[model samples]
Target: MAPAHRDLADIIITDELAKRASEPPDYLREKLAFRDLADDMADNPKAVLPRLVRLAMEACGAESAGISLLEHEVREFRWFGLHGALAAFEGTRTPLDYSPCGVTLQQNAPVLMKHPETVYGWIRSAGISIPEVLLVPLHLRRPAEDGGAGTLWVVGSEPGFFSLEHVRVLTELAAFSSVAIRMIQAEEVVQAALQEQEQLTREMSHRIKNLLAITDGMLRLTARTATTKEELVAKMSGRFLALANANQLVRRPFAHDTISRVGLQQLMETILKPYERVSTKGLDVALGDHAINSMALVFHELATNAAKYGALSRDEGQVSVGWSIHDDRLEVTWNESGGPRVCQPETRGFGSTLIETTVRRHNGTIRYSWLDDGLTAAIILPLSSLAR
Candidate 1:
């Protein structure tokens, strides 16, 4: 019951073939090659490409090598790397058809000129120099959708330097490296576009908010006129123009976090300029460029009322408006003296509503007191809302 010798031999051959098939693909070999190339290229790209030029020459067993890349902006060929006597070609640019690499790229294939001297029949007509050439297309996938077909790699020197094995390896590596370059370029483009879109969105939001505020201010100012119905209509037309002016100031070519503090002061003064003729000699008004927009509007309306009926209406009356910051808020005091005896109004009007709304929007509080001689208004506004 012994087994035949042929059966044992067949069993051994089958086991060996199965073991070979079970072994992994040579991914480790490919990874090691890529790591070595990347390490060599880490320090300086100019040196890396040039040294790659020399290594390619050694791999082909050639006397020299020249490497060129396509520069589509110039529609020309440029020598990016060189080895040995051909090193002078580095940094040189020439028309596409006048360079050997140009033909490889245009044809989308490899070119091997076996005879150095006799290839001139084709070379001479194209205005190219031929002394033995091995040109390979560095075929890259498009960097962006609009990119041209790949790049060209020209390696030329003495004759018969490129073996079939050398051509195969170089072509494969060039294809992979070109795609990596295109990927890097695509990521940069996407990042830039995102940054620009974010900036535009912020600016648009700012402009829309400013326009709404201006329109609301104008409507309130118009409803307060009490001269005659005919005069009231004329006053509204003027208020509309002032609103338009303020809108133009806020929307301009550059970015700013808030209206300029100095500009806010001037705008407030201009808004109340018509009331300066009030006859009170002792009436004093003091404000500065440091006040914010919400506070500015509140103080402007209070001044207008004083000129019409409070301390500023008579020569012997006196009034003062001043502000100072304390703790987390700003405290403003409006005091009057020597005016007619104070009394509370039975109904609130447009002026009262404007002042209340502007201060409340900033989360501020206001109190008005009627004393025997005059009216006093005190305001406290949080600094956090007004600082910027």
Candidate 2:
């Protein structure tokens, strides 16, 4: 998805989650400090998990920092928070045997080691560069026999970086974060689980909403089909399936991850597959992985409608789906001919609704004109929205 469309509502909602994605946690201390009082933080561990972790990173004097959680299935270290580091590491997991953090975690003890010569063997394999390194384990309170209290902290840096004093200060800070880490981790687990439930609920709701809408459409078709409603309903159901299939292309578990770049040719082929028997003889559609999902949905619906009523309905129809980049904007035009004359839809229906609504969301423009013999829709989408 383009960076701009990454801010879509669906993406925004999930972005608020407390996953242990890799990021330096301490980068947001000032903001966290201002947002909550010490008392409030004390009262609410989950509320301050991000802040506490952020604070811990600041104390360590590390340019990049992150939290790692044990994945339930494999017991591997999964990064949760990150700061001043590569974003690609977000949600990426490292093997327990492969990670130094994993070593400290398993021993339930902090391992402070900084040897440039021996370090590259393990850390470099993870694509992380560090001249010196410190590993601290952040732990929750256990029975007195289970190593009473202390959190392990891991610090890695370019060679010859941290002095003993720096490690000392980091240790002191970890003392405070240790307590906070336990509270925060427990709270995050509950919150994350609850968040998953809520997301499932919302997705189920969206599915139910789609089902009801289709059911209602089917009922309407049945009522009107006293003579041919069944066949019409069947066709409509197939069309709806096509729409759903198109949606699946744009709908991912993570909204920000949706709207991938796809070739124009592939988009039309998928949507037009159901109606290719009637038309598509001379259609030429080509696109690089430049198209986003929202735009693709609009294209899909347009093609579906064309196949059912306009240019694609006759043996003489041809569709040319192509787009050209112009001044940082993309202009995709769909031209069709060789079919019966097109009559503008009498009343707006599902296809029109999808094209208009989805395009408008991304600040795109859609213009449909019925020519003497066929239909053409010119869609202009800001290149900024489709930019990676």
Number of the top lDDT candidate: 2
**C-alpha RMSD in Å of predicted model 1 compared with the true structure:** 20.9
Per residue, candidate 2 scores C-alpha lDDT tens digits across 1-388 of 1121211122111121223133344436545554563555578755454555555556666655556655547756666655555335656666666556655555554444443223334444555554344555654555244332323343445434444544455554555555666666777777777776677677558656755664565456445533575766654665566556555554335333233445445556677676664333222333322233454556666776777787777777777666777787777777887768878868777557766876776678899889877888888877666552
Q: Write the per-residue lDDT of candidate 1 for residues 119-222, one digit (tens) a residue.
A: 22333444434334566666445434423333434344533334555555556556644654455456657666676567656765865686476556656665
Worst 10 residues of 1 by lDDT: 8-17
Candidate 1: lDDT of 165? 57
TM-score of each: 0.40, 0.40
Q: Each candidate: what lDDT?
A: 0.55, 0.56
